[model samples]
Target chain A: MTSAILVSILMTLVAASTPILLAALGELVVEKAGVLNLGVEGVMLTGAVAGFAVAYSTGSTGAGLVAALVAGVATAMVFAVLTLSLTANQVATGLALTIFGIGASSLIGAGFVGRTITRLGPAFPEALSGHPLLRAVLGHDIVVYLSLALVLAVSFFLNRTRPGLILRAVGENDASAHAIGYRVIAIRYAAITFGGALAGLAGAYFSLALTPMWADSLTAGRGWIALALVVFAAWRPARLLLGAYLFGAVMTAELQFKAAGVTVLPPEALAMAPYLATIAVLTMMSLGPKSGRANAPACLGKPFSAS
Target chain B: MTSIITRRRFNFGAGASAAALPFTAGRALAQAPLGVGFIYVGPVGDHGWTWTHDQGRLAVEKEFGAKVKTSFIEKVAEGPDAARAIRQLAQANNQIIFTTSFGFMNPTIQVAKQFPKLFFEHATGYQRADNVATYNARFYEGRAVIGTIAGHMSKSGQAGYIASFPIPEVVMGINAFHLAAKKVNPNFRTKVIWASTWYDPAKEADAAKALIDQGCDIITQHTDSAAALQAAEQRGVFAFGQASDMKAFAPKAHLSAIIDDWSGYYVKRVREAMDGTWKTGDVWGGIKDGMVKIAPYNDAVTPAARAAADAVQKGIVDGTLHPFTGELKDQKGVVRLKAGEKASDELMSKMDWYVDGVQA
Candidate 1:
């Protein structure tokens, strides 16, 4: 209950939430564009490994972040080519991509395993961020700020901009959007590419900012959690931010409470709290007046083969 | 001794399993190297539990040279899936397969029944069949040593334990560590955080950070990763590496490590199989037998801490001190072991309760 412990808990929560928020926000855009890409897990793994390997080699965390973006987009492009270009089953291809990511990352990460690197440091200097109370908000690295900013940018792009409206139009009714000369396929492609870049960044956050090391499946299936988050937020970027931080708080609280030596519940039950909360909230979302499914883009997951 | 194989069926079913062994010896005599297969729950590069087992695999290859062919399937999740992986090794003509994970117990037993002739060694499992054996290191002995170090070096009087599960093996380690630390500092407390998974770096790091932030100055983990050590390093807290020496991962924070040395056991077991001496039984090797070894003390480990840790290791090896000794009590003040008595293997094997001063 000390202020120091509380601050530490806050710090851990933000760090834990930022990566998922980034990935969820990216997936939110993808889903909004009427493309249901389930390969976020695989794409994130490729980004994590590529990020760690590049950062370890170049000794520049910046270069590592760039590599992660490129790797993520590249792997996402594979899904795009198969699903978007060839009109394959998105669900099956997404699962296959995850399996491929697991194997490929392990093979590439073999060398980087057992290796360590300089972790991303706070963006602000100690003068401002070192304050115990202020540290909660200011001590975070660049990704934390970037995630919040992206949420705003994504919200604006989807609602305020003309291109955003066209993109949403394509998702809502692709054939109609195509009839209106919106180039539905091209807009969807761009949205999918943007989503991949963000997911890749999120994966890099895990490798470079979070653990600063490489291991097989290092993202630990957080990509799937990000995918769930898109649904949890009903594809709203701002709500996605809320959901990610909420999930992070629950996850961190589970560990922090145990670390504080408070026996509120058995360890198993404590470990299951975040997951139970997720299921409960999702159920509520489904039963609410505005059913979450109603918010889904009509053409979502449907392969378009305009004959 | 081949007496470890505890089956007396004179029936054809038993005879068929026994018949498979002679075929293995015959194939070896026919100039075919003994095919040894290993299945790991984590990647070999984990630098922890599976990494140590993989090292043993390399040792087997080194000891036998061309007389043995070793192959491994890494990152095999333990479940029905593990059975498939184990069977794939069996189908590939591997004479002896090592399934190295606790969760692989059922799958290992099931696969051994099908490959009645093929020998299977499952690590840290309780089950054994005619073709299935279990072998494990006395990792508690290593824990006792590190716990002693934590007792002497910990300024916070609180140490963090990053645990993987509630199994006897993990619980035994927690009790051993808490007991040893309490022997040095009677008021010492251990905080245990069950991570559920053995090898998730992100979660492990978070657990370590939570503990360190909560004022647990010393961190020790039973999980199979160096992530906790790295977390402790970031926070400038003392830590003990698990399974392997991870000093390089956290040079400043690493006080010592409980190293799992399986190379000697693997070499001996492989040799036994080649000489037609393989049998199904349980083998629990400790410091005395070199199955568990303590790493060299870091410079940061004070002289007093080093002396105390070394004394604990020596006592365990010489049988002068037992971790689960006289007048032990569970957290609820119930005496589990009375004065002048020691815990038996059966008690340790099924240990599920936490000891006094252990907040798990």
Candidate 2:
């Protein structure tokens, strides 16, 4: 294959992986804050529909993206109030939030379906962005760059900063953190809401950039893939980036090979490739000492009460 | 998560259109309108397969006027949940229900037995029972025409087929498309990328991009989305739409679309059920029956390509053409059909191998 083919394949991998990376990065922060929200898929849909609707109505892809983030944050707030403020069962409420997102987005998106808008443009000028080799690094839309920057920001926030330490401490032992004068529920609410906003952005990438149209459940279960990716990454931001890209490469390669009239494995097997990898990573995580499970938030999925 | 189902119930009489069927008005006014139920696997807004079926449902409403009330449940999953949904409609006084997805075949059959008095029509499935009937459109008939265009128009002598799965329905399309392209340019090649999904715009677009990058300039899809067409549009290539007229989605790239017209058959079947003539059987309607049709040719199509495509379309309708006529060989050069012999419905339904020059 020519270098052009290789470059194009790499480009496809980036497009396919961007949304998952954004969602997983936001989720990493939420998990690091000691909360487990399975509503990533639901939140993404809510964001996707909002983004498409706004973009279509205002005729501005930029407005659509802002609407997606705002909608995502708003929707995530519901989960926050329920689980953090009211002390509802985190798992059940998260699941319910997902259902709410799905139904609500469908209802709201009914009129916007089949509508198209200008796709989010490349982040750089055409001359440099479209260059044969430069395209690999600069060909992406704003969301792609934002996603990468967010990864670094998230990784730094978790490992190198004072508040990051406090947040990590809260996740490690909420009771201890509370004794140290940190507000456990407040920190969790903030984390969950941030996760919601990112998930929304991820969903908008589908409508605004990927396919450039609105459809119900347009994410098509990618949010679940994002959730699994967080686990696959062992709750680490850097690993999340690697896993998302690796998974995207496998998926894009499946189509690229078939389009090139070749196949290394059965299509069905390729479809299940990521889940198989996730399973292998999971088994190794459990078997290896402190490499996998050791990294999970201590207070993950557990509800906290100040009293 | 809470599942989202776009439920559209045509309760209000279709206003003045109801006046067309006045002959049955007195009897209809004396009783509740016949309850017609439909469940789709995708949103009506899909503007693809489910959208066309929704059009059929609307035709039923328009034809029967106040004599029949139609309602549909969209985004229905084809699983154990399907059986529950089917039963929900059955028990809700739906006299005749249409389960419009292949995966709902078993559940439709199962529910038909439990409600033996009600009629059920399952699309794209062979299963049948006393109260159940099967029906589908010959999409490959339309494929042959598009394949002709692909052959004459492609600069690379290659076409891309983004398929949903390796099911016989899909395999037959790949072959029919290739056969016509081969007839035009014997050296024409087809690349098959199984998307393994019925509807996913993002993945569909990705697959189309991959195919275009690999030199297949002419794109066609068995998957139900205009994303492939849009992708081709962005890349300045040619593509055909599936299940509906999608020229709106990709005005530049769209060569044409294979429209699924279920309105006539749906109206006929509903009329038969009301008249006590509905029977348990299989119905495969094609161009002859108006179940499948090609959209208008784009002006970009060379006059010769248009003429060849029209001839095949007309021939299929006149019974002078068969997309899978004899001398056909699999990818391995093994003859699947002898010259001058048309393929059997059974063979087409069970086709599992690719035709010569088709890379699967």
Candidate 3:
């Protein structure tokens, strides 16, 4: 009975964490190339509504996921043009992107309100789902497996490739990359677009798999949580998966405590557990030791300019 | 023949020709399309409160036919967005505007004062003026019937209530339901969960499940969703539905539902307004008037439960019963109503505190 319950809970944790995992993976790539985009939430939400609206009308969940990615990438292109091409402040541009995305998505999603859509199929093959341990790890919507694979692929790309080293060089010191004849602006723009498409896919996972319904403010700060996960992972692709899943487990436990008939604390306190833990972990990581910030990219939020 | 006489009598100095008839023709053309508009705080789907109101709009169109032209804007925000929606409707030539929400009261009043020619009707609010009339269903009257069913059906003496906000309307409902529940079972206690938002299914479900985990076998809500019913069904507990009939959402678990029938009132008011006989007034309708109705009880309810609910329904409809009649205690255990006394409109309107037996 305990094992069955654990399996069910782990399955829920995967579903809950997919959007965050997909989004943070993209931001991980962006950060590795040395750009800070706070507009991740805004991009995710726009994708969520846009993807659902299209899927709802077209009766195609795959189409919906693709549309979400395109919407995310498109919004990122807007940011790239303004910040990368115009040399505008990245922080201000990202904030404006979020504000714009919120208003634009609301307007576009107005027609699809209160409509329901077909639920997406599971991510893994039925053969894999039949296995005990593999079932718990792999039985999710298609986006979940893709996001997990993305982390592994990103880890390999960032650590094992010459292009990855060049991107890192651009981030750590764009002046040094420029001396070596690397195109700094082009790399950052590509990173930003990649970040947005991932954020969009995260949003699609929400509408396409999680609730399968459209609602205002549906993402509910999942983007912000993903943003925080980047720091919690210390800029490592593999660590991001652990951080995202851990936060997902914390959230799932709070809900399951009531479901499983365990009433150790008031429901309100339990409801706040995940957010409180995030804050606690962040404080510990920031204040505990000098070694904590060692893994963060040195030029994570700094913008580069060529004279 | 009347036009000829009126044209000569009113325009005595005018020549007797077709050019003199242009004024009357222009008047007829000006009154060609009568615009009607609705402002919503949430999206209008095929379910819930906003959907129900949108149904009323469709009813108005069907009732009036081509006499009225209707348009709507959904998901209008509570404060400034409400004001903008109202102005847009009025400026677009909507002579009759229905602003549907409690938070929309002040904004509706503000817009009504500015556009005196337009008739504004605010739902679930008390403030009223010449052009700004307020109307709401006597939802507590429906609660009295459902509470009686819950009182008989609940194996545990604990009942759960999912309430939205601490305003008078919701507070009155909580008090009324607890009073009715206590009348049947003296040991009955209500666990109240305030969600603080009008339509959040996830929050409402979580709250309902929390209450059930705390030993509540029966539940009811003053919010606007079938989520509580869905939650109750998942937990194998029974609950009453709110705003609209939610039998489809949780057929087995839903004992019954309190349905808001705004069509009758909407038709009457719009007809009167178009005929120039409309007068601003509060229309707080109850079960007797068919504005509030109880849906069919589920089979899970015992024979005794059915009889009790039916008796209350008959009493309300036949004027033999009043939900707020006789001795009643406030949240402080102070008796607010004595035996043989009927609850006053003033007290019911300003009911800010919960009654005894309600755990907030």
Candidate 4:
């Protein structure tokens, strides 16, 4: 392949991976705090519509990003209240949230259909971003850089920081953390809210940066893929980033091959590449080394009540 | 929900009372305004396939003001869920129902059997029964028009087509586009990328970018989102919209569009149902019937390209140009049609092979 084609492929890969990486990172933190929020899909949808609507009406992409974060947090709060406060079943609530998100986002985004907005542009100056080779590294929007920074920040917080240690303690053993007066429920709530915000930002990336248009189900199950990425990464932020890019590469390969007139496989088979890779990686993780699976939070998916 | 139940019960009770009268009186009682229902496979907010159908539904409301009442359930899945939704519409006393996707064919037939008195219209489907009528637009005609324009404007002679699936309808479009482009420039090459979905914006955008990266100067799509057009606009390539006008999303990159206009057919069908003249038949209307409309050309298109596109559209409408005319060959160099003949609807409906110069 020519350098130009390679650059284009890498750019598309990054664009595709950023959203899932952002969402997966948030889910990693939520799971680390001993909560399994299955409502990521619904929350992301809410964020997507909220972001597009605000951006379109106000003519400000920044305001749109903020709205998306708030919407995602608000949607997550609904899940938090039902599963955390009301002691509802986490799996059932998460699934219900997804259904609710699909319906609610479509209803909310009904008016914004067919509307367009100025896309989120590059973070660097035109001279630097416009160069052929430099453009590959500098041409990405601000969210792409932010997503990478979040991966590093999250990695540090979970390992080096005191609060991070305490949060991990809460996830590892909520009863012990509660006995130590760590406010287990409150920490878990905070983690869930933070996760929701990141997920919202990821969703906003879809409307404000990725395609810059609003359509029903525009995220198109990428939220579910993000959920899968968390599992594939074994709930680690660093691994989550790697897994997102791997998935993005697999997805981009299908388009690249078809565009290049490579007919080694039918288009149908090519389209299945990403999902096939996901299953294969998950299988390898299970059948190979046990360290990855062993890293999963001990109290993950278990609802805790101090009373 | 309770109010709907109460209304249904009242309608049933009234129908029972009306049925108790003589046959002629019962027929007169059925004249209490035609109730029409529509079931969409996707959300109306898709702004493409489902949106066009919803527009047709709105036209029905406008055309028959007080004479008809219409309702719709959006995003109904195409399997068992479709049958349940169709049954619900039938039970609600809707005299006519429109199932607006090929996936709804069997479900529509199943529900039609249960409610023999109700009329059912299935779009882009071949199946029909005593109460079910099939309707579709010749979208390939629109494809040919845009292909002609692509031929004139494309400097590289490399056009990219983003397809949703490998269904015969989509295959026909790919073949039609390739044939028309080749007629203008024999060396014209077209690339086909299947996104395997009808409405995923992210995937559609990626496919468009991939096509543009491979040196395609023009892009066209069968997917139901404006993402491809937006991608083309961002990448500085030309594209044509599918199913609906998408000029607002990509003003500079959008050369023109093929809009599905179902208003005329919808109004006529509703009138027929109300007049007790509804019949089961297949209706495949194209440019002549005004079912398929090409949007206005962009100023970016050269005058020569615009004239060529107009000529092809006029020929199709006037029955002079056959998009699937004779002397055609598949990608394998096997002759599919002999000279001095036009492709019949039956052959076109089942087209599965690509034409020469189309890279699938």
Candidate 5:
């Protein structure tokens, strides 16, 4: 391929990967704090609609992003309350949140259908953003950079900081942390809220940056794929970034081959490639050393009452 | 005066006898405001397939005024859920129910059997019973017009088609676009990509960008979203919208669109049922019947190209042009239709093979 074509492909790949990476990173933190919230998909949908509606009505992309973050956090709290307080089944409650998100987003977004918004544009100046050679690196919107920065920050926070250590301690052994006076429940709530915020931002990425238009169920189950990425990453923020990009590349390969007039495989097979790759990667991750399986928190998915 | 009196008496006698018949009892009950119900497979706000259908429902309400009462449930999933939804409409006393999705075919038939007194209409489906009727638009006719425009406007002679499925309806559109493009430039080629979905904006946008990167100057989609058109606009390529006019989404890149106009048919069918003339049959209406229309050309289209497109549309409407005429060959170089022979409705409905110059 030509250099220009390669750059175009890279650009599309980055765009495709950013949302999942953002969502997966948040889930990684939540799981690290010993909570499993499967409501990522639903929260994302709510964020998508909230972002689109706010952006369309106010004609401001920043306001729209804020709205999406709020919507995401709010939706996440529903799961947090039910699972963290009421002691509901994490799996069942997460699934219910997704269904509710689909219905509620559709209802909320009903008026915004067919509406268009000015897409979130590049953050840098046109001199660098428009240069053919430098454009690939500089042309991306703010969210793409934010996602990468978050990966690094999360990696540092989980492995280096004192609070990060405490959060990990709570996840590893909630009872011991509770006895140590770490406020296990409060930390878990905070972690869940953070996850919800990131998921909301990821969801808004679809509406405000990726497609720049509104439609019902626009996320199209990408949220579920983000959930899978958390496991594929073994709950590591850095690995989550790599997994998200890998998935993005696999997703773009089908379109690339068809566009290049390479008909080696049928269209159906090409469409199935990314999904098959997801399953394969997950299986390979599980097949590694038994210690890899131990990466999951001991207290993960277990509710702590501290009574 | 005596002759007029006799005629009036004869008309009254015929009407009384028709109402007295057991089979016509349901028609007699139509004197009350006719209730029309629509079942959509997607949200009405989709701005594509379902949106057009909902527009038709609105037309029925506008045309009949208080004589007709219309209701619809959007995003109704096909299969078992469809049957229940249809049954609920029937129970609510909707005299005519329009199930607007191919997947709803069997369910529509099943529900019709349970509610024999109701009139049923299914879109893009083949099944029919005494109470069931099937209707479709000749969308290929509109495709041919746009294809001719794409051929004339494209600089690279390569067009990209983002298809939803390999169903006969979508396959036929691909073949029709290629055949028309080839007529303009025999060396013209079309690249086809299957998204495997009817409406995913992100996937559709990616497909458009990929095609544009590989030298496709014009893009068209059978999927229901404006993403492809928006991509074309951003990439400075030409595109045609699907199902509805998406000119607003991509004002500069949108050359023209094949708009599905179901208002005429919906209004007519409702009128037929209201007048007790409804029947079980098939209706395939095209440009002539006002079922398929071409949107206005963009400012980018040359006057010559615009005239050519208009000519093609006129030819199809006047029965002088046939998209699947003789001299057609499949991708394997086997003749599908010999010269001077026109394709029958049955053959067109199940067309699965691509014509020459189509790359899938």
Candidate 6:
């Protein structure tokens, strides 16, 4: 029974973590090339509304997913031009991008209120869907599988590939990279855009797969969770999966506790568990020996300069 | 064929399409008209408060025809974003603006002061100016009935209330529910849970479950979301819906719902504004006025329950029933109203204390 619960919990975690994982992986890549796009939330929201609207109109979930990616990329391009091209403050520009994305998406989603989209049917591998322990541990819609695969793929690219190494070197020391004849600005822009695409994909997953409907402000700070997960994973790709899943499990447990008849805690307290856990994790990580320089990229928030 | 020929001939003579055209079309076509703007804090769905207001807007367009043009921005954030959004709408030539949301009260008042000629209507606020009119539904009237029903139906002598804020509007509902529940079951007590949000499904669901786990069998909410109904269904508890009919989310669990109908008020007010008859006043309408409605009772309600609810409904409509009749007690059992005394508007408006049966 315990194993069954454990397996089911794990499966649920994977499903819940996909959007965050997909988003974090993209940010992982972006960070490796030294662009900090704090506008992931806005980009994801844009993707969510756009994807839902298109899918709603076209009656095709695939089309909706594509539209989400495109929306994310388009919004990201705006951020790229402002920060990467115009040499604006990365943090400020990223914040501005998030604000713009929120306003635009909210405007678009207003008319979509209370409208139902056709649910995307199950996407788990057939064999695992029916299996008892295996099903609970492995089964989920496509987003979960995509998130896992992307994590592994990102880890491989960052550790083994020539271009991935160059990206990392640029993030670590852009001046040194510039001196060595690599185009830092171009690399960071590409990385930021790719990050935006992934964030968009994450947003699409929310509307197209998870809840499968459009809602105003529906992302509910999930983007911030993705960003925090990046830090919690110590900027490593493999740990991102574990950290996101763990947070998902904690969130799921809060709901399940009330469902399974735990009456000890008040509902407000239960609702606060996940946020409180995030705070605790942040505090623990900050207090750990690896403090400042161990996990974060040295030039994580620094903008690339030609000089 | 003969009928079709006659219908065609009738159409030619009657000019149905031409008649359907707005008489104001000529005037509108002569010059570009001023744009009107609406800003909402919620999405305009088919049910609930926002949906009702949107329906009202559609009514205005239908009534005024082409002479008046109105547009809306939905799900606008409260503080700075609201200011910017209002400015944007004003810049876009919106001469009149309606800002909906409690948080928009001060901002709307401030913005209206900035644009004196521009008319502004705000919902659920007291602040007003020559151009700013305030409006709200008398939600407490509906709560009084729900309270009575809960008082009669509660099996566990415990009820749960999902509240959105600590404001007087929400607090009044909580107190009213508790008072009514106490009338039916003197031992009955209520657990008040604040989710601190108007609409968060996950949080609302958990709150419902928590209340149920604490032994509350009847649930009422002053928040948005069908999650409470969903939670009640899972727990096989009796619940009441808020804002919108959430029967789809909790068909078996929901006893009834409080639905807001803004179309009537909206159409009247907007037309009045367009006709230059719109004066700054506080409009608060309830059951008797048809602004608030209780949906059909579910199958789970017993014959006695149905009869009781029907009787209450009749009383409300015929002025024979009073939800806030005299002889009410505060949480400390202090008598706030004497027997046969009607609850004053002043008392209801400033009600900040919970009744005796509610557990804070």
Best by lDDT: 2
B45-116 per-residue lDDT for model 2 (tens digits): 788888999999999998998788776777777766788878877865568999999989999988898999
Rank by DockQ (best first): 4, 2, 1, 5, 3, 6
Tens-digit lDDT string for candidate 1 (B262-336): 899889888988999998889999999999998888998888988888888889989998888978888788889
Q: Chain A TM-score of model 6 versus the true structure?
A: 0.90
User: What are the runs in model 2 whose C-alpha is more than 4 Å off?
Assistant: B1-32
- lDDT string for model 2 (A175-204, tens) is 999997999988888898889999999999
Q: For all candidates listed, what's the TM-score of chain B alone?
A: 0.90, 0.92, 0.89, 0.92, 0.91, 0.85
In the predicted model 5, the residue pairs found to clash are none
Which wins on lDDT, candidate 5 or candidate 6?
Answer: 5
Pairs of residues clashing in candidate 1? none
lDDT of 5 at B311: 90
True lDDT of residue A172, candidate 1: 89
* Model 6 error, position A82 (Å): 5.3
lDDT of all the models against the reference?
0.85, 0.88, 0.78, 0.87, 0.87, 0.74
By the TM-score metric, which is better: model 2 or model 6? 2
- In every candidate, how many clashes are there? 0, 2, 1, 0, 0, 0
| Cα misplacement distance, residue A105 of candidate 2 (Å) | 1.3
Candidate 3 deviant stretches above 4 angstroms:
A1-25, A46-170, A181-194, A208-210, A228-307, B1-30, B148-160, B178-190, B199-202, B208-242, B246-256, B295-307, B325-327, B330-332, B339-342, B355-357
TM-scores for candidates 1 onward, in order: 0.93, 0.94, 0.75, 0.94, 0.94, 0.74
True contacts kept of 5: 0.61
lDDT of 4 by residue, A194-234 (tens): 99999899899999998998887778888888888888887
Worst 10 residues of 6 chain B by lDDT: B1-10
